[model samples]
Target chain A: MAVITVRQAISDALREEMERDENVFILGEEVGVWGGTYAVTRGFYDQFGEKRVRDTPIAESAIIGAAIGAAMTGLRPVAELMTINFAFSAMDHIVNEAPKLRYMFGGQFKVPMVIRAVGGGGRQLGATHSQTPDAVFAHFPGLKVVAPGTPEDAKGLLKAAIRSDDPVLFIEHATLYQWRGEVPEGDYVVPIGKSKVQRPGDAVTVVSYSKGLQLTMQAADALAKEGINIEVVDLRSLRPLDMDPVIESFKKTNRAVIVEEGWRSYGVGAEVAARLYEEAFDYIDAPIKRVAQKEVPLPYNRTLEQMALPQVADIIKAVKEVL
Target chain B: MKKEEYLELYRQMVLIRRTEERAAELYQQGKIGGFLHLYIGQEAVSTGLVAARQPQDRMITAYRDHGVAINVGLTAKEVMSELLGKATGMSKGKGGSMHMASVEKNFWGGHAIVGAHLPIAAGLALGDQYRGGDGVTICMFGDGATNIGYFHEGLNLSKVWDLPVLWVCENNQYGMGTAVERASAVSEIRQKAEGYGIPNERIEGMDVLEVKKAAEKALAYIREGNGPYFLEIMTYRFRGHSMGDPERYRESEEVDCWQKEDPIGVLHRWIVENKKATEEELKQIIADVEQEVEEAVEFAENSPEPAPEELFADIYAEEV
Candidate 1:
């Protein structure tokens, strides 16, 4: 198996889907001839031509809205917002129209659409350009929010999202784009709403996703040297959250620490912690601890930005608190 | 326009006006529930556009869409039953007045959320063009919706893709309670199309003939592969925005003045001026429409609500 980065895996998934079905098309700012903001769609324009590979204007709302419209009327559209922070402009279409159409109209219509945006903070892009908005989307009932932490996971879950009949918000971490991992070079799909245990242990459980998953792994490795074996759970999907693995892991570990890059207030980690207490209260040996970014606007200064987001040390601290 | 065509437009507009008047009565009597946005004075816009559309063409509009449904061949009975939340309604009583839809009629929908349906309208046109079908979509919304971001996005994309769609604005002078001048930065609704470089025109919406003429030009432009067209129909709402509206925003004289330009009255004058028919024939048509509307109300009032067990049925295509 060839090693591939998360960026390549996503582009490969898109290319494979486009090759498999003529109905699949990609549209976004700087997506076609300009490659992409992250160059994830390099060489896609020449192969797909102008029809299937489109370069849209800097209108995030229009890009997603058009994709939703196209998806409803037969095409399977994969709309790319340059960054997750920019997706707020299109929140109405994604949250209100795309997700609710199937239920509001009594299942007479379905918006088979996927909105792909790069999220998570580490690039010193400041507050406006750097944010993890998955929890905000997760608050909605009809949407399916997927955050894949690895290249293989990205490839597999994206295929699943494109094939599904519901609207899927496929969020990728900007910092994880260059991280490499072995990916299967064939047809595969990782079902949505499933969480995977990356590292198994019995002392404590560290749950996270995207960049948070990487930090959790680092923290897990550091904690192991101290003889405190920790289990790391990468929450692949957030909306239809797969809490079974988390609860079972908690039952064995008896302690848990959830991590997220979004702000602490009403964040995904908070939700995960709440669910842990609700399901496995008796199994827990201690109170659940959370590691999230500070609840303040991210500063553009390097030192301040780094301090605002959760690091390996932060996860380590949270793990120690839970243990 | 020919006398026959003018009379047809008048007939459709009169039917909608009378039907909505009866609907107001139903709401007062507690037969219909939910927030109902009546398409009273704006009847000419729907009738005019539907008259110019091809049989295979599609149509979509905002919540003020009872007129479009009726013009697209849904009987007053079906519409009335839907409003009454009867099981025999278009959406099996699941969708209320603000969310009516019919796939078979090619009417697309009665979407809420201001200008949300514009993109869907573009998609319908895109699909028709891609499939080599000689059809187009007429997307309708209120004057207040022109200020929305989706309106510009949808219009620009329609122009960029050269999609076959007629974006019709039924400017009834108010967007809910906010007047056109209050909410918009630039209040000339027709000029809103300039940013997209699409052809646009402002028409007298009170007259059915004028609306039909403008719609005919717009429809021909789209049909000829010239891309999307926009029309701003200057009209007024004879009733409040909804059933519970206090209507303290506008003066009583304003409503009375617009009522005089009622689409039906305008049509009747034209019919009399052209000597198309005696006054008795027009009166008979009105009586027949009223009878049809009454039967529809009876059917809706007697119809059953959805079964209690079916609440969980249509949540998904199948069980999640």
Candidate 2:
């Protein structure tokens, strides 16, 4: 195992996939000559020729639509949206076209593509740029939505996403890119739609994913210092959500707290809470607690932005409330 | 073109005309559900274009796709079954009037979104280009699609990458209820290709032979690796945009005027004038189309509904 940033893990996964499959190529604005906006693909342009690392114009529809088309013809195109905010521009292709092509055409075509989008609220990018809209993409049935919190999960899940036949939206949190964690080397693939218990305990169950999982882990550590053993479950994939671990943990602990960076209403927290109530109602010890961003278009001011976004303290408070 | 080819083109246009006419009737009888965009006056555009392409070349089109589906060799029965939402439909009744496709036939799809498939067409061409093949993607859309951002974006990317795509705009006068002049900056849709630095031409779409000749030249240019070529075929739809269209936008006189240049009528005259086929042979072809459509409707009515389990199937290729 090697400790690396989430950025490096994702970058390595992409490089390895492209090397393994000649059909795999990258296309997006500034993906080629600009070496990627966040420097995730810094040396990829020079390593792979222009044909594989294509630079596209600032047209989200074309980038995603073309990617879907290429994927239909047996090419694995990893299209990068400068940010998840830009996904709304190509929302028709992402949600309407790519997902529906195979089923609508009665399995005549397959969109074997990956849309890599950066999301989350931080860096004071304002309301439009800063959004954790993973739930919106997760709402669709045909598209697979994966948001990995740790470096290991990022590397493994990304490789799996690229190899999957369906269209997978691999969302990377904008703020979690530099966060470092241990990642396994050599062809490691963590299957999509599986949840793992990152930190096991018996006191209370804390379920989160992506940036929220990072915050939950910190809260778990803080609670541990005070002798409160809280269990943390990382939801790797949002669409085919593996509620088995979550339900089992809830059955054991009898108390649960769901954490997410998006809004509380109709968000990931709401979905998990509803599922828990419906599946494991007998295990309930208290009303399920949810820690999420305050309902507001994330403000521009650094102080206000951090205030609106969910933090480590918020997760801890939610856990303690459930306990 | 050979005499047989001309006769074949005439047969295709008549088949499309008859199929669409039956579809309109079925829709009125409440048998066919959803929006039905008939390709009555614009049959020559797709017929000619499909006739000019090789087996390897790909084709994609907008919501007005039943004609393109038949032009690419889909049986009238299959097209009607799809329209009737039967299990034997091209898409197994999953995609209704606007989503018929055959990968083996190289017909990409019957995409419903206005300008959405333009970029997908570019991607199909990009795939061929990446593999270093001579397959050109022929994308068909309406005049209204040219006004959308996807049109410009798809066109610009095709030129920048020098992908093999022939963008064919079947400039039927109205987009839904709005006229081309009211909705678009330039009424001449092919001129928009100039902004992307792609060579383009405007052709008379009412004449199938003319459309076939122009499409051949445009496709040849792309096949030769010169890059994407734009062909804007001037045409009109004799029927309303779709079933239940009030059509308050255009006058009856205008519809009648364009009706005089009906694509099928133009082809019938051209075949006789050029001595491609006798008048008796042409009339026999029309009678044959009538029989084909009658049988198609009977086949569609007899076809079964998809099984209850089909609803949950094919949503994802890989099971969760």
Best by lDDT: 2
lDDT tens digits by residue: candidate 1, B1-320: 56666667767887898889999999999988988889888887788788888887888899988999898888888889889888878776777898777777788788888987887788778767766677888899998889988898889888988889899888888888999999988788888898789889888988877777788778877898989988888988888899999999999998998899888888898888889877988888888899999999999889899788657665444234
Number of the top DockQ candidate: 2
Error of 2 at A269 (Å): 0.4
Model 1 whole-model lDDT (C-alpha atoms): 0.85
Per-residue lDDT of model 2, residues B1-320, tens digit only: 68888889888989998998899999999999988999999998999899999999999999899988999999999999999999999899999999999998999998999999999999999999999999999999999899888999899999999999999999887888999999988888878998889999888999988988899898898899999999999999988898889889989999999989988888788888888899999999999999999999999999999989999989999988
**Worst 10 contiguous positions by lDDT, candidate 1 chain B:** B311-320
Q: If you assessed candidate 1 against the hidden native complex, which CAPRI class would it receive?
A: medium
CA shift of A173, model 2, Å: 0.9
Q: Candidate 1, which segments miss by more than 4 Å at Cα?
A: B1-11, B92-94, B129-132, B269-284, B307-319
Cα error, residue B95 of model 1, in Å, equals 3.8
The per-model lDDT (C-alpha) reads: 0.85, 0.93
Q: Write the per-residue lDDT of candidate 1 for residues A158-201, one digit (tens) a residue.
A: 99888878889999998999889999868999999899999999
What residue pairs clash in candidate 1, if any at all? none
Runs in model 2 lying further than 4 Å from the true structure: none
Cα lDDT, model 1, residue A23: 80
